[model samples]
Target chain A: MAPTLCELCKTTRALIVRPKNHQKLCKSCFISIFETEIHNTITSNSLFFPGERVAIGASGGKDSTVLASVLKTLNERHHYGLNLILLSIDEGIKGYRDDSLKTVKRNAKQYDMPLEIVGYDELYGWTMDQVVEQIGKKGNCTYCGVFRRQALDRGAARLDIKHVVTGHNADDTAETVMMNLLRGDLPRLARATSIVTASAASDIKRSKPLKYAYEKEIVYYALHKGLDYFTTECIYSPEAFRGSARTLIKNLEKVRPSAILDVVKSGEDMARLVPDEVSAAGQGGKDVLVVEGEAYRAGGCGSANGRSSGGEMADTERQLLESEKAQGNETEISHLGQKHDRNCKIPNRTLRKLPKQQMGKCVRCGYLSSQDICKACMLLEGLNKNRPKTQIQVSVDEEDNSSRLTRRMESLKIIPAEQM
Target chain B: MSTQSNEAGMVLLEVEFTGGLELLFSNQRKHKISLPGSDEKGQPATAAFLVRYLCENLMKDTRKEMFVMDGTVRPGILVLINDADWELEGGDLYELKENDNFFFISTLHGG
Candidate 1:
């Protein structure tokens, strides 16, 4: 308990040294105000959606593992009213994903939540190794990112989920802001500007519950909980550019301890809030409810280029009608065949006739289908259009054909009928 | 000594990846840093590079903001600088001057 001769008193600014990169705070300061900000961030924003299914995309790493672990804790203590579920997407990389997958599974078991794991190999018919072979490393992030995003959306849709929660933290957000700014990606900048507001307008309404949480706090939480997790990193991520940003932040913290937080705040500030004028696209501008007609409501705010010049678009039939009404000009609006009535009540017996074959079972996704295949398979196949030109086994189980009839009686989670 | 500014304040910060959620940080002059995780040494290229960038960008005169590496694949690994999490508060914005200390750590997910 001997006091250092150079130590400063509580009131002495002269004794204070700017904390270095690795130093979080002084011992006395650590006890005073560590997690106060995090508490304020969550309570202030009401981050969690009420009585809705929240799927945490768990990667089993410190980031995602920490996220899932803390979310479960907070949900219980705070009663966030979330129907939480664990979602793990396996990109099917060899050395990288194998061990990490184990951690995700272990975490799922510990959390006592039902987990839905969608594998890229099975769903998209392509793995990272296969992707690397096809396009090389030169822009694989584009492919992986797109495919991964679509897959998450497709999976969430199949599960009837309203929101997808990710484990992105402040550092992640800041680096992204920098990367986006560097690349001049205005669309993404305009899209992701919202921290916890209007989360529904985006494709899947991804929320970063860890938006304000720090990596340090997350680690402390895990360590304090003695949570067993996979500590290794993805096998193929060494050459990524995000590595560069992490380095920059460290050096800056030496001089300005608040650099990382400043960067993160800047990113948060950069996000554009959705204006109330463009608000009609309610329900995140997406009526994911399978209630019919409502599906077309999704794209009203998708993009300016896609909409008709007159702010009206119609089918060829509608086109024919419009031409007939106004021969000289193409200004007439046509609303025929619009799918806006998706919610119109249709009794089970009145549903569209399944092309007899669609009543069969799909080889992929194990769902019943009106087209001999299931929607997941159709989408997965479409996504794999450029699937590595490698040889595919194309294996189909012998029992599948015979069991297809029996699939009707079985209550498999996904219905087999697929969209083209 | 007169009221001269502390010039040796430069920490020559370096963060090393020890293992998952574990990192080690030390100025070039320190023989050893007791930070937990891996028994690693010789600044990781990404960690060192980031520290350098932060230094120049933040207009820092010293390497006081050096952060160790937590096991993250991407470059944005969170470092505990001055006990204030770089991931939480203004990460690089955390100021550093003479006598100031820092720590680095990564995010955690609940079980």
Candidate 2:
């Protein structure tokens, strides 16, 4: 076979077949074009201000590794004047997290950026290993998801850095869109599709710089550049809900490469239709900015939690907590059942009149929370109260269930026969 | 690295798998594989033929679906032929040549 000329250079043999668009380019042109697109995403979104300290949430995974390398190159070439730091969360899995953090350490040196690691032990007084021990790994992801969300904020706060960026690519975002759409989690769908989820109530701002980038491209960039990265599934069982959605997206991409980006565009378009009243009050008036070429952040905080599944579960838990806060306003039981009941008339009205986000410091940790105590504090209270490792189980008969999310949870349930 | 590619001969190639796909390829990232120059139908061997060779002869893992589906590399796995995107080189139909470098990278793993 004859070599194909690069689309841009037209001189060198093309090495890359871009997934978003089927453009083929040589290595040098591909690298530049990838970086330039990311630069456009950053600039048009105004993700960073000059001299601002932004932490690259690093897991030593390919996405973060590529993100660090590209951001460093862009910062130097474009004179962005950004102080980029590598922030990692050590979930304290005996063999898993301990090894990935080493890659992050090497990345810190390789990228010449300062590194900060916040562990589950320091934040929650419980590593994932211990959490899995207590919770029996059935629903430990809920704990990790809740804890990691706050941990990233707390880590950024500790560094006195307000803005944190993650390596969530287009595929991840597209998967989240599909997951949220399937789950009917409109508020979270709105949250997930935002390039920047910024709340004045909290100092830490979260953004995804690689939101427009494709996962394949990120891995390709890492491999082509020989950027050091680690790839391993979490020691814990995977979340079935997001896994199915991810599988669907991968299959769709296989058939149509543009399907991923199309899903992202559809998510953004759907987000715009979310009632302003719903968006305005959900995250303490957190403006969900859909910046131009501003890619939506996929499971950004799922670095330590693992995979798109972690992000979906965490978002569900978050929605649960927020709804709990809403129901705390004198409602006896959660409207979860009623909300899912299509015939329930009052639930629609009730959903529209969401309770104003009650921003307050967690009584235990001083972190931002809508409840009297944050979700983490609430989970910790439960764990500390049940020290003897009581089996906590939520039994939902899968056959009669109408909610796809519930059925997914049913499948993801770790069977007792498959114990560690 | 045998460079001979006579019609009735065999092609020696370097097949590398990474990003955890090596777990299926005998937990080895790089394998030197010798494959017949032509298939049983007497047609020139191609990448699709190599995928079958790896599955039937080299794959130590039981999860064949993880690597191949519908007669091609699985959706998430990337194929690079001689440092070029296999998509540019005709994907699964690209004829295998002696001493070619084939890298199969799985993007399914956590980033």
Candidate 3:
């Protein structure tokens, strides 16, 4: 076969066939176009303002490495005047996170960005290794996921940064959409598809600048540019239901490369169909369920807002209640009627009947929580009370049983039912 | 064109794996392999044939499913032939050439 020229340059040898548009490009052309597309995503979405402080969620993996490289390049090239920082959550896994965090440290030096790492031990009083020991590795992901979500926010707060950008690409977003759809969590589907999500308090905003980028391009960009990145799966989270969805997405991409971005677009479009009342309830302090593997590292992190469902509504609803109080008796009666309508729809199993979640402060950490204590705090309380009598009881012998543990985790049926 | 005679006409090729797929191949990223110029059916060896050859001959890991699925390289794995996408090169049907570089990168790993 003869060599083909890059479509963009029309001179250099084509080295890449882009999945999104199927355009062939040379190495230089592909790099420039990849960076340019990311620049466009940032600028068009107004993802950043000049002089804004943004934290890059550095996982030391290929996606986050590419994200840091591209963001740094774009910031300097376009004169965005942004202060970029690398924030990593250390789950305290002995071999897995310890190895990856080393790459992240190298990435920080390579990219010339300041780095901040928050560990599960410091934040939640239990390392993942310890949690797995206590819980037998069957459901430790839940503890890790919940802790990492807050750890990121707390890390950003310590840095006084208002926003954190992650490396979630089109593939991750599409997987989340599929996971939510399969679970029949429409409200979460709405939140997951949104480009940006703010906590109920609206303090820190989380965005995925690579939300539209393909994972293939990310790995290619890292390789062509010679960026140092890690490439190991979390040893503890090798197999989960999300892994099945991930495999399905990959298989689909093999048949049709466009399927990944198509699923993303479909998710975004479907998000609009969710009733306003449902989205409102989602926004007003409901605890959004966290997707395993999405939180600190690759876990979906439950829609990026970090709220749970079915909690007492906090300030937002109290404001509504007070406003109703000021209105005439008839308006007050109608507000109550509206509440009854939503509550009664639960029996009918309708989508609009969102569990009324109230935003409140964690009694322990004062971080926002729908419950009196946040998930991390609650998990910590359980671990602290059940602290193993003998230290380091996490048997090394259990290492051989991880596959069995994953199978047990799958059978745990923790996946919320369609109706919840 | 006897099958035994084809062994004398082996072609040299370079194979590299990245994005954690190298773990399946004795944790070695690069291999210089010599292959029969043609398969048993007397046709030029294709990428599909190279995949099977690598698994059976070079791969030391017992977990073959991690690299190959349904008799092909797993779906998330990308194959590049001499720096161009194998998809642009007829994918599994692209015939192996002497000294050609085959790069397989897995996007299935965590990021």
Report the alpha-carbon TM-score of model 1 versus the true structure: 0.51
Give the alpha carbon lDDT tens digit for every residue of A1-420 in model 1: 122221323432111122212323333343223233344445555566568788888777776777677667666766777777888778878876777788888888898877888887876678878877766765555445545665666677668886777777655665566654554432243334345433221235676666655454455555446776666555555435655655566446544544555565444333322222122122222221121211122222232112232212112213222322342221111122123334322222212211123244456654443345543454345446755322322111100121222222122122222220
| CAPRI quality level assigned to candidate 2 from its DockQ score | medium
List candidate 1 segments past 4 Å from native. A1-39, A197-203, A272-420, B1-17, B20-111
In order, what are the TM-scores of chain A for the candidates?
0.58, 0.77, 0.76
**lDDT per residue, candidate 3, B31-101, as tens digits?**
99998878768787888989999989999899999999998999889899998888778888888877889
What is the per-residue lDDT of model 2 for residues B47-88, given as tens digits with 9 covering 90 to 100? 898999999999988999999888888888899999998999
Chain B TM-scores, listed for every candidate in order, come to 0.32, 0.92, 0.91
lDDT, model 2, position A367? 81
> What is the C-alpha lDDT profile of model 2 across A1-420, one tens digit per residue?
478999999999999988766888899888888898888778766788999999999988889889899999999999999999999998889888899999999999999999999999998898989888887877777777777777787889899999988888889899888987776555556667777867534678888888877888888889889899998778797677778888899999989887787677566555544444334444554433321111112111112111132224213322222332332231222112233334323211111122344678878988876657766777787888876333433212111001222232233322221131
Clashing pairs in 2: none
TM-score per candidate, chains pooled: 0.51, 0.81, 0.80
Which candidate tops TM-score?
2
How does model 3 score by TM-score?
0.80
Candidate by candidate, in order, the iRMS in Å equals: 8.1, 1.0, 0.9
**lDDT, residue A418, candidate 2:** 19
Q: What is the C-alpha lDDT of each candidate?
A: 0.45, 0.73, 0.73
